[model samples]
Every structure is written in structure tokens, then in C-alpha cells.
Target: MADLASLQSGPLRDLPYRVAWRARGVHAGAHRGTSSGAGGLFRDLATLLEAPDPRRLDLRASLRDPFEQLYVRRFERSTAITIYALIDVSASMGFVGNMRKLEVAAAICAALSFSARRIGDRFGVIGCDREIVPELHLPAARARAGAVVAALRTFRPTRRGAGGLVDAAAQIAGRRKLVLLISDFQIAADELAAVFEALAAHDTVPIQLIDSAEAASLPRFGLLPLADLETGRRRLVVLRPSLHAAWQRERAEHEALLASLAARYARPPFRIVDRLDWDRLAAHLMEARG
Candidate 1:
């Protein structure tokens, strides 16, 4: 398990994240906002007819053009981004093989909220299962990383359906906020697909939480009885060498399909719950910034 204190205090304490998509916030911060302002990051050159901002006219560009058409500079205004940590507190997340997935989720949430605070971004947390957990919904605020961590610590995985993701995503405002979605994706592809569609308006960062045992080799010879965490259905089956190999292949294919779908919105980052590494997550955040 990751040390919560380490996340709150260390070299990674004030880790910064790069926003992949432009934010639509009105407050002044780090991310690029949709609304243009007097002073911001220079975007590119544009014709005066297109921009209509005479004050931004580039005198040199206008002189270079033979036709002498006026050129204006376009800038992207910096705005404070609202970072939301949407965590899945379903029964599957409680899988305690080598480490509890719920603990991993909470740790990640702590790190993200602290990082957001360091960058002057508003931080929020939404814990959901079959339904949204009202008590766990923390509205976006600055310097509330400790409160977010405390709320996540109280969360316990319960047996809940996976139909609330779309509804939960809808609860977020359509202001192009940054959503750090952490989940052990045990739901069906069709259901998860709806969630992606609902959250298309925001910049979602998918952190697929996986138990180490899930990716490891299974017993080649055993009569294992597996029970569905959500449905509570039990099935006993003999695990042969062939069966184990087939399961591995199927899991790989499913992961590949998920990666393809997730890439359309944000780069997917996989975190093994048993051996959570902050450095690996930092690298992913850096890549995401690009």
C-alpha cells in the first residue's frame, strides 16, 4: 500500500499535471481557457478579418505579406481547472489479494488532489457505486486535499451494480474540467462505453485499477469456484493448462479493446494495486501533460 503521508509530503507533493485539453474555467490559473483575454499564451497568427482584434495586429507579418493583409496574434487564456476524482467504490475494488484496491484508489485520489492544490486548481471527489455516494461528493475547492483524503478513507467497497457511471458522469458540470477517474473496470464493455460517452465533455484521465493476481498466471490444475462480486452468482470449473492459457489471451484482448476505446479521450494508465508505484504514475501524468 502507498503511504498517504508520502503523497501529502515529498518531492512528488507538488507534482504538476499538464492539461491535454483546453479548460473552460473563468478563474485565472494554469490551464488554457476557452475565453480569450488581453494577456495569455500566444497561440498563432491570424488575419485581422478573422480575429477582428486590431490591438493584436502583428506589424511585421503585415509588412511581409505582398498584399499587406493585416495579421493578428491569437492567445489562449490561462484558467484554473477543476480537477475531479471520480472513484469507483464497487465490491470488486475490495479484492484483497496482495493489496486492497480501495486503498490504492484512495492513495491515488490523495496524490491527485494534493497535486491539483499545488497548481492552484480546484479539487473535487465523487465516490460512486451502483448509485452516487452523496456523502462522498466534495465540491471543487482550493486547499481541501486533506478533506478529500479523509472522505476517501471512510469509503468501503460494497456489492453494487455498474449502471450508475453514466449518471455520475452527468453530475459533473460541462465546463471541460479535468476528471481523474479511478476504477477496477469489471463492468461490461457496453456499460462502460456509455460512461465514456457521458463524460466526453470533460478531460477524463482513466486509471484502470487491476489486482496483481489478475494479470498473473492462474492455477493450471484446480477446481476453482468463482463468484461474481456484483451478481453473487457462483460457478465451479476445472482450470487446466489450456483453460488458463485461454483466459490469459481473453484478458489481454479485452484490455487491448479497452485501451483503444480509452485512447480516443485520454491515454489510459494501468495501476497494479499490489505494487503501486508513484514514479510510474508520475511518468503517466507527465505523458498526459503532453
Candidate 2:
């Protein structure tokens, strides 16, 4: 913990070490407490988001490292925008929480922030569930990213409060900037058209995290216990064939609703990412550079 506190407060020398921390989800808390888990590499990475806006690269610097600024000076145009990381920390997110979804989503956002920085776009962090956790604020500085990631890794979701996605979209600034909503997306967030219409004026993308059980529709043999990770509520529910079929039906409907929203909010040229392959999340990460 002492080392965790110190390293995040430094720069240059701490880069490699911090990267390891964030990559491995190392720090303090359920999602990040240091353990010999498989997520250690990303734990280190979760900690690397501590750069304060590479201040050396200003508008005049053409959003490049100083050397690159000199080479591409003429081609640089000003369309600087902002990218907001709108994450849901609702308890359902942690129902089976092992930090994989939360960790991956944070890494994706960190990666997005890195790419945004390259294009002269600013990054801001927002963690919400039924309500806003960290009041929305800009994190243009590199150092702020670690804080953002740290907060995210510790964010928890609940069962009762369901947030309004459209309302969250209105909290951001910059039309050029994109709002990324990352979640497991289990609950019905209302009518698809209404949700997309609310954010029609802005650029928004919803990233869903589906666990293996959810993907394969694991059998619910005998009496199964379902615990609400958010509310700490538990119930022994009987799983029947008909119930499983109904669940599958609802999941399909949920996906269709998501597709409809994406279709409505996007144009051919700037089409939103509609049901990206969870199995190939890495590919999406590499290709989603805007």
C-alpha cells in the first residue's frame, strides 16, 4: 500500500512500474488488491494512467510529441475535442465481480484516453450507476488518468437504482468528443429508440461485457442460488427449461434493442459499434482508435 501510494505520485521512473500495477489491478480494494491472480499484468497497467496532459504538446505543438510537431506542423488542423468515459458501477457489474469486466473496461478507456491524447482530444472520467459517483470532470492531464482508473477499479454496482443513460449523455461537452458507455448491460434501459434519440445529438457508444456463463447459457440444474452482488440480496430460484428458454428470449430481445439503438444513433460513415465480439475484445480495442 505504501508503494502504491508513492508510485502514483511520481513520473518517468515510475512509468514501467505503474504500468505493471494497473495491468495487474494492484492497489487496494476488491477489484485491485494485490494477489497472484491472472489479472496482475493489467493491474500494473491500471496504475500507469498518471501523466498530466503531456503539457509539452500543446495546440501550438500540433498535438504531437515535440519532434513530431515539427514534422507535421503544416498538416495539423484544429478540431480538438473531448472524450468522456461514462461507466456504470452498478452492483450487478460486480455480482460475480472478479475484476475482469471492470479491469478490461478501464483498460479500454485508458487506451481510448491515450488515443484521444494523440489527436489533441481531452479525456474526462465519469463513473455512474443509479447515480453519478465521481461528479463528471475533465482529466486532460495524464496524471489524472491513474486517478480515473483507480476510481473505476473500485467502483461497485447495485441492484435497485437504474440510471437514465440519455440523461448521462447530456452531461458531456464537445460534439467532436465521444461518450463511451461501458457495462455488462443486463437491465432494460428503456425503449431503444428513446435511449438513442436522447443521445442522438451526441456521439455515444455502449460497450457490453458478457461473462462466459451468460454467453453459453449455462444449465440451471436443481435449485440454484442467485445473489444480487449490488444489494447483497440472495434468493434460491428454481431454473426450469421454460425459464431458460424465456431467459434466452429476453437476451435476444435485449440484443435487438441494442442494435436498433446503434442503428438510430449512427450514420454509415460514423456507425457506432453494435455488438462487438466479446471473444475478440482485443481486436475491437486496436481498431476503435478514433
Most lDDT-accurate candidate: 1
For candidate 2, write residues 236-286 as lDDT tens digits: 888888888888888888877777677667321221122223335434332
Relative to the true structure, candidate 1 reaches a TM of 0.80
Tens-digit lDDT track of model 1 for 1-290: 43434533544344457777677767788877777777888888889998999988899999999998999998888888888888887778766666666666677777777777777788888887888877777778886566656666766777666666677788885777777778887767787777777787777788887777755667899998887777767899999999998988878877876787687756675555566677777777766542
- Worst 10-residue lDDT window, candidate 1: 3-12
The lDDT per prediction is 0.75, 0.50
> Which whole-number lDDT from 0 to 100 does residue 158 have in model 2?
52
Ten-residue stretch with the least lDDT total in model 2: 14-23
Root mean square deviation (Cα) for candidate 1: 3.7
lDDT value, candidate 1, whole model: 0.75
